[model samples]
Target: MYFIPNENLDPTLNLAMEQYILSGLNLDEEILFFFIDRPSIIVGRHQNTIDEINLDYVKAQDIQVVRRLSGGGSVYHDLGNLCFSFILPFPNQPVPDFSSFTEPVIRALRTMGVPAEKSGRNDILVEGAKISGNAYYHNKFGTVCHGTLLFNTDLTVLARALNPKPEKLSAKGVQSVRSRVTNLNGYLPGIKTTVEFRERLLSEIARDAKTIELSDADLANAEGIADERYRNPLWTFGTSPKYTLKRTRRFPIGEIELRIEVRDNIIRDVVFFGDFFTSQEIDPIVDALRGSELETGALTAALRSIDWKAWFPTIQEEDFAAFVAQGD
Candidate 1:
C-alpha cells in the first residue's frame, strides 16, 4: 500500500482529489489517504438533500454542504473529524463486504485500547455508540472505500445540522442523532489532539507503506474538477433520482401549494393549488418552470422573467423563487 499526504480543509477539493487519485491515476497497487475538513455536511450520492439536511440551520451556520460519490446517510465533519479512503482493485465478486475494509481500523483502534467493533452493515461502534460510518464507490478503475471517524466532533451541532426523517429515526429506535453517536477523545489512552490520533492511526494501519506526494499538475487538475463538479449546485442538489415535491406555504395574501415533479434534475411538471386568489391565468407561471432546473439560479432566472405579483398581488419574485427552490 502507498500513502498520500493531504492537509487541505476544503471539502469539495478533498472529494475531487479522491476522485482524481482513484480514476485519474493508473495504479496497480492499493493507495491510502486521509483528510480533514472544516465544518461541513457530506451527503450521499443517492439521497435527496432536501430530506437529509436542515437547510435553514446549515445555511445560517455557514456550513459547507457537498455530495459524496458513495451511498449512505449524510454525515457532519469538522476539524475534529478524521476521514480515510482506500483505493484498491475490485474483489472477484464485488459484493458489499464492509467487514473486510473496516476490520483494519477496528484492529488499529484496539491497539490504542479503544474497544471499537463493526456493528451493522457499515458502521463502527464503540460501547454500542457509533464512531465511524463507511461507504463504497465502484468504478472502472477499482473500488473506493471511504469512511469518517468521529474523534472529537461536536455532537450538538451534528444533531442540529442533520434532519433525518422521523420515520428513519423511529425505525432505528433512536430519538435523536446525539443518542446514537460518540467521540473517541475520551476513549483514547494518551492521544492529546486529533492530529496526534491521526498520525498514530496511520502508523498502525500501514507500518511499512511507501509515502507518495502529489505533484503540482495533480493539484491543479483536482482544483479544476472541484470547481466544475463539486462546487456546482447542480451536481450537489440536482443529481438525485426522480421525485415529487409538494410544498404548501401561507403568504399574506393566502395559502399556496406547489406540486413539482422532477426527473434527472429538470422540472418535468408543475401544478399550483390552494385558496389563493389570482386575477390572471396561472398557466404562464407553471409553464415557466416546466423545463427549468431545480436550482436557485435556474429557478430565479425563470421566475424573474415573469411578474409574480400579477398572480399573487402580495408575493415578490425573489421570495417565490426561494420558496420553490428551498429544501424544506
Candidate 2:
C-alpha cells in the first residue's frame, strides 16, 4: 500500500485515477492505494443514480456526483472518509470473485485495531457496525476492489446526504439503512480528525505498496478518460433507459395512486397522486418508467415480492405497484 496524496482533488479527476490504476497498474505486483476526495456521491455501476442520491440536498450543499465503473449502492464521501483500492492480478482464475479479493483489505483493517470483519454479502463491519462497504470490477486481466472507511465522516451530514427515504430499491443491508448507523470515530475516538485518520491508515497500508509514483503519461491518460466520460451526462445519466407506468391500488394500512416512468426497465420516476409521505424525487422512477418493460411481472407482481411489510409496514406493495404500473 502506498500513500498517493492527490493535489488534484476533483472527483472527476480522482475517479479517473482509480480507472487508470486499475487498468494500468502492474498486476503481477499487488498494489493498494489510499485516495481522498472532496464531497461526492458515488453511484454503483448498475444502480439508477436518480434513485440513489438526494439531488436537491446534494446541489444545495455543492456536492459532486460521479458514477463508478463498479456496482453497489451509492455511498457519500468526503475528506473525512478514506477510500482505498486494491488492484490484484487474476492469474489462472482470469477474474476476481467477491471473497478472495476483499480479504486483503479486511485483514488490513484488523491490523489497524479496528476489529473490522466481512458481514452480510459484501460489507466490512466494525463491532457489528459497518465501517466499510465495497464493490468491484474484473476483467480477464485483473480485478479492482475499492471501498471506503468511515473514520470520522460527518454523520449528520451523511444522513442528510444519503437520506434513505421511500423504502424502495435499497436491497443492501435493508435493516442498517432503516436504522441508526455509526462512523468509525465512535469506535476510535482518539483519531477523530480526518487527516490523522488518513495518515494512520496510510502508515498501516504502506507496508504493502512497492512505492512507485505515477508518470506524466499515466496522469495524462487518466485526465483524458475523465474528460471523455467522467465529465459527461450522456455517459452518466444517458446510460440508464426510461419507462413509465400508472395505476391505483390500496391496502389495509395505506394506499397510493401514481404515474411512473422507468428506464432500462427499472423504476426511474414516480409521482404519487395519493396520500404518502414519500419524497418528491420518486418522480425519477415514474417519469423514466414510461414504456418500461418489467424485469418481471406487471408492477403489482414485482411489488409483492418486496417485503416492505418490515420497514414501511403500513404500506402495501399492491397499492405502491398499482401507482407504479399505472401509466404504461
Candidate 3:
C-alpha cells in the first residue's frame, strides 16, 4: 500500500478527506490512504449521538467525536491505532458487498503473522478477540469502508469513549460491552509501537495499490466540503432525521415469533413468543434498533444481518418485518 503520511491528526479533517475520495472515485483511480491520528470517537450514520457517546470524557480529553457516513456502532481511534481508506471505482460495477472488501485487511493480517478471521459478520478477530471492526458508507459515487486496527492503543480511552446503553448500566460503571472486546496489542508479544505495525500493514495493502497523490485541487475540494458541510453543527449534532415507529408483543409468523414495539426507529417494546433466546445484551441491540429510520427494507436488512443467536434467537427476517409492518 502507498503511504500518504498524514501530518494532520484532526479526525474530522481526515474524515472529510475520505468523503472527498468517495464522491470522486474515477474509473482508473483506486487510492489507499494510510493516515495516523490521536484518540477520538467516531459514531456511525444511524446511531443516536447522545446515547452512544460520553461527551464529558471526550471533551475533557479534547477528543473529537465525528459522525461517519456508515451504519454501525461507534469506534475509538488514536495514535496507537491505524486507519486505512480505500477509494475504488464505483461505476456500472456493483459497489462491493461489505464482506467482500474486508478480505484485503484479513489478507494483510496474515502477512503480519496473525491468524485473523472475519467473525460475527463485521469483526476481524485474532484468537477470538477482535483486532478490528469494519463499517461501510455507500454514497452515489461508490462505497468507503474504514475501521481501526487497535495495535498498542489505549483501551481505557475506548472504555471512556463508548457510553453503554441505559439498560446496560447500573450504579457502577458500564457493565456490558466491557468484557467482550480486547486491545489489539494483547496479541503481539514484541511489537511495542503501533507505528511499526502500521507501516508493515501499509506496505502490504499498497503493494499494487496505485499511488495517486491528492492534488492541491483534491485537498481543496475536501477542505471546502469539510468547512461548509461536515464541520457544521447542522450536519453534526443537530441534523438527525425524525421518524415514527411501532412494535408488537408476542406475535407469530410461521414457527418464529416476536413481542416487539417500535418508536422513533427503535424497538420500544419486545416480547418472546417461541423458544428463542435473545441475548442478555438485548437491550443495547434494542437501543440500536430504536430511533431507527423509517426505511423498512434497511431495518429488515439489519435484522436479517445480525447473528440472531447472539441477540435475538431464531428470528426470521420476513416474519420480523411483517410483524413490524403489522404494527404500522
User: TM-scores, in order shown?
Assistant: 0.73, 0.68, 0.70
Model 2 deviation from native, Cα RMSD in Å: 9.4
List, residue by residue over 1-328, the lDDT tens digit for candidate 1: 9898998999999999999988777766788989999999998764567777899999999999998777667899999899999877543335346787899999999988999999756789999899999887776667788999999999999999999766556645788898989999999858877789889999999988899898999999999999999999997787443349977665544346677898888889876644333434578998888899888788878987888666655676767777888844
For model 1, name the residue pairs that clash. Answer: none
lDDT of 2 by residue, 1-328 (tens): 4434555667788888877776775546656766777988887654456756777998899988888776556788887788877776553454345566557666656676667777754678776666777777665456677888887777666767774435422434344442444577766667767677766766665655556778889899989989997888775554433325555443332234554465666665554432222212233344434344554346555455444443345665555444454432
Error of 3 at 147 (Å): 1.9
For model 1, the superposed segments whose C-alpha errors exceed 4 Å read: 89-96, 239-328
The TM-score between candidate 1 and the true structure equals: 0.73
Runs of candidate 3 exceeding 4 Å displacement: 1-5, 25-27, 166-175, 239-328
After the best TM-score superposition of candidate 1, give how far the Cα of residue 197 lies from its true spot, in angstroms: 0.9
Top candidate by TM-score: 1
C-alpha local distance difference test of each model: 0.82, 0.63, 0.63
